[model samples]
Target: MKVGVVDVGSNTVRLLVASVGSGEVRSLEEGRAHLGLGEEILLHGRIRRRKLDELDAVVTEFARIARKHRVRELETVVTAPGRQGGESERLLEVLRRATDGPVRVVSAENEGRLAYTGAVARTSVGPGVVAVCDVGGGSTEIVVGTALLGPAWVRSVDIGSLRLTASLLHGNPPTRTEVESARASIREAFSGIAPPAPELALATGGSARAIARIVGGAYDAE
Candidate 1:
């Protein structure tokens, strides 16, 4: 089987396609375009025409690629800022017009689970309880439990880098006030629900990787 992963995010629209279990098909067909989808919606409380135009163009290009590959089945999923009801409806319509295969809008909860699964799969599995954190463009999924993530204990926070950056930080490198304020915001949201602090574990997103990259010494070598 052939599979594709599409993340119609607030800041970017991304797609990756690969043939299942085929070592020969090592490189997945991938594409990316910045729509800055969150710039207005999550940042300014509404969507703007210019951004939608930019998004339309990106989805069109991705759809064209999927059709060209003659993919048996294509799965496109959206997250975070894309979860807004009416907002999602409008963006999804554009995606349908762009792709040849099936495109489904995944819920925020499910998106979190997928992320948790993806994170866990990359690590040593089934030893004991493992916590997974998925910090995204508009949401953060923190899965704290013993037997993988199930509903009850899994919680998601609607504060992500884009939201924090847009709302709190305005300077190029971020002001000290913004840093402390956002940290305070995180601590506030994390109140009461004391998740097991993440172990020295895999930090999966760019925000994490960037920190690693910036820290440089031990992390950058790998």
Candidate 2:
């Protein structure tokens, strides 16, 4: 069966179409739009009418693309853009108009679980606990679990690179003070949180990819 999923996120709206059978899934098509909903939320506390209209258009296009690809079922899910913003009804209504389907704002725990599942599915990991970290535009999710048992621990930290950059890093290349301030904020956000140690750790999302590119192959205490 071919299924489509549209993700309404803080920084980007994405669509993924896949064929699933025999306990395996194969990607057919993927699409993304950098809508920067998080920046709008930070600026105005909610998605404004103009941006909502743009979102509606984007979702409508994505739905059309899915149908063109012969997707049988399509689901739309919203992340921090819907959860952290105000006037959710407005957002939902716009999305429903586009996809003509129910749009759900998934909880943080559900988000973490999904990230964990997707990350571990593509990697080779042992039976021991694995951790998946997803850094979105408005939040960061940490999920720890084994591949067999699924997520055992899930945490959502309400600070991401977009929020951090918008709030603190002002310069193109942030000044020393701004960098320190960003570090301080990150430490504070992660303070008092202790997750179970994992034998393997995987990261997902745009910010993580950008960091990986800058740092080379893998990240560590080095």
Candidate-wise lDDT, in order: 0.68, 0.92
Q: What is the lDDT of candidate 1?
A: 0.68
Best by lDDT: 2
Count of backbone collisions in candidate 2: 0
Measure candidate 2: CA RMSD: 1.1
Candidate 1 residues 1-222, lDDT tens each? 666666787666887777777443443689888666666786556566676677777777776676577667777777765665245677666667666445676776787677666676656657566666677777777775544443234677787778778888888898898889989998897787776655433455657767777885234226
- Report the C-alpha lDDT of model 2 over 9-82, residue by residue, as the tens digit: 98999999999999999999999999999989998999999999899899999999999988889999999988
TM-score of structure candidate 1:
0.84
Off by over 4 Å in 2: none
* TM-score: model 2 vs. ground truth: 0.96
Worst 10 residues of 1 by lDDT: 144-153
Which lDDT value does model 1 have at 96?
70
Where does candidate 2 clash, by residue pair? none
